[model samples]
Target: MKIFSLVIVLIILFILVGVFVKRRSIKIRRIKKEFSVSNEKSIMESIFHKNFLFFEHLNNTFKEKLLTDSYVLSKLINIDGVGIQITDEIKYTIFGLVGLLILGDENPDYFPNLTSVVVYPKMYISDQRGQNKSVNLGESWNFGVVVLSWCDVINGTQNFSDGHNVALHEFAHQLDQQSGQADGIPVNLNNDYYTWKNTFDKEYNNLLREMENAEHDSIDFYGATNKAEFFAVCTETFFEKSAVMKSEHPELYDLLVRYYRIDPMKIFSN
Candidate 1:
């Protein structure tokens, strides 16, 4: 009787696994179909081309991929606006910035664990850290949520050379959090872990030193706050001030190039 019960349990488990696999397969097929068929020409022209100077620099292939990835992300992530109405322009804009980050991946996860995005008309007050309220342009929570200020998001994209992007900075934290901790180290490094750690450590220390001396630096001074913030700040510089970063910090530039799998210098140069 026990053997029969064990067999029945095994059969149930097998059936459950089969159902899960089938559902996953169906989802993937639907995503692929949506990716291929979705049209985003109007949004590309109205939102991206008009505001995002970086969009103009990308080649046609990159542009198409960005649109597809952005569309996919929009479909996957739920975005809600607080004190503002959600619009396609806003959704595509946010997703486009994220799409740029994962552009090189053959099969991007599309921030699988991201639960939702919350946008505000402008800066919002948050006391998540403690009792003291602080104004923030954006925040990425470990609970799989990202909050943003729409005004700051537009400002970041419009000024392509500013080396400051709340979207890039916050989403970077989301990437860092994927390692199960927000300690500046990201996942999928494999054997490159040591190399990444070495470079990031050296650069992070150097930034701290520069901040102490009050010396002018290409990277943001806010990076000196912590290792995680340093990684996010470096991401901002890597994309916006690629030429300056490459010229000033070649090793760090190469590391970012390898990690992101895209050379912003080449794209921006165009």
Candidate 2:
């Protein structure tokens, strides 16, 4: 009787495993189909042109890829608006920024660990870190979630030259957390880990010194908070103030170009 019970349990387990595999396979196929379909190009292009200044600057090939990537991300990630109506424009705009971040990668995983984005109408109060209440423009949780302020996002999109972008800032934290920790380092360093660490440490210390002396800097002073925050702030400056960063910090600019595999200077040059 015990032998028979064990056999039955094994059979049930096998059946459950098979069912899970089949469902996952079906989901993957649907995602691939959705990604390949280009029926929404006109609508997406309109949204991009209206909201994202960077879109018009991109070449035709880059624009098409960006749209396609944005579409896939829109479909994959669940975006929920709090105290606000979720619209196609909002979805595309948010995902378009994400798409831009990974645009240079040959095989973008599309932030596999990120499942959902929660957007508030504006900055929100949070007590998640215990007793202290804080107002935040955005937050990126290490476990499959990101939160953003819609107003801040819009502001970030409006002025491409400004280094303040909540979406880019928070999403950058998400990238930094991909290595199972929210350190300044991310994965796929391309064998430049030592250089990356040395450069980031040196730059982070420099930012700290600048903050202490109350000196003006192209990079934001907020980056002095920590290595992770510094990376995020650097990402914002890299894309928005590409010309200034390139001219001022060529080594850092070159490092970013290699890591991102795209130069914002090319897009912003025209």
Candidate 3:
């Protein structure tokens, strides 16, 4: 009886080892597939793909560096309509890709840090009871979810006539949360927080004064709502009207370039 029991125990141990080994192997393969960097040829091919229409709007160098890169494309693909309601339209698919590209320079790790994206048909009414709108324009909840409205996103993009992308504006909040806080700033970028704070306060105050006096011409009035909104609004101008932002607010523009690690002004200028 003792001998038989010992043999059975050995067999069970062997099975457990095999199972562990198999699971480890599968994990390794998935990691490789998910994080693999795209080679030059792969990136070049992706740039020419019909789906990547946003590439045409970017400068050639940025186009080549970001669009041609497979790692970048993978991040874009990850922005699926998961865990959130969305309107049944082709634009959502296209906007998902465009939003990713707009934020591509932030590095893949920063793009989809949130577990899911919650999309709505239009500017959602704010949950705040008694509010007129049921969803807010864009918001990143305490839970790992980011919400956006398609109508606001489309208007922000098509109206490049103005500097306000609700999608970019909201996603910027997610980036700011990457370092564990959304104090109107993101980490991993080579910036002096002290200096950033000082400069941001000065500019923010000036903008607030401008907003009060109704002096500024472009961008949305909502930006003056608060510091967080200021950052989002400036991000819109940074990507959409880099030239104007660079010329008008050189310090702020420089800080934004450092934060995003990409000079969008140069990209748009090209």
For TM-score, the strongest prediction is: 1
lDDT of each candidate versus the true structure: 0.87, 0.86, 0.61
Go through the candidates in order and give the clash count of each.
Answer: 0, 0, 8
Q: For residues 1-270, could you state the per-residue lDDT of candidate 1 as single tens digits?
A: 999999999999999989966775577568768667656656555788877787878898888788877877887789999999988778889989999899877777778668799999999997676557889999999878999999999999988898999999999999999988898998777777999999999999999999999988889999999999999999999999999999999999999998888899997667
TM-scores, all models, native as reference: 0.89, 0.87, 0.67
Best-first order by TM-score: 1, 2, 3
RMSD of 2: 5.0
**Which segments of candidate 1 are over 4 A away from where they belong?**
1-28, 129-131
Worst 10 residues of 3 by lDDT: 68-77
- Model 1, CA-based lDDT: 0.87
Query: lDDT for model 3, on a 0 to 1 scale?
Result: 0.61
Q: Pick out the ten consecutive residues of candidate 1 with the lowest summed lDDT.
A: 36-45
Could you tell me the lDDT of residue 192 within candidate 3?
76
Better of 1 and 2 by TM-score: 1
Checking candidate 2 for backbone clashes, the offending pairs are none
Instruction: Give the best candidate by lDDT.
Output: 1
Residue 89, candidate 3: Cα error in Å is: 7.9
Candidate 3 at residue 89, lDDT?
39
Per-prediction RMSD in angstroms? 4.0, 5.0, 9.7
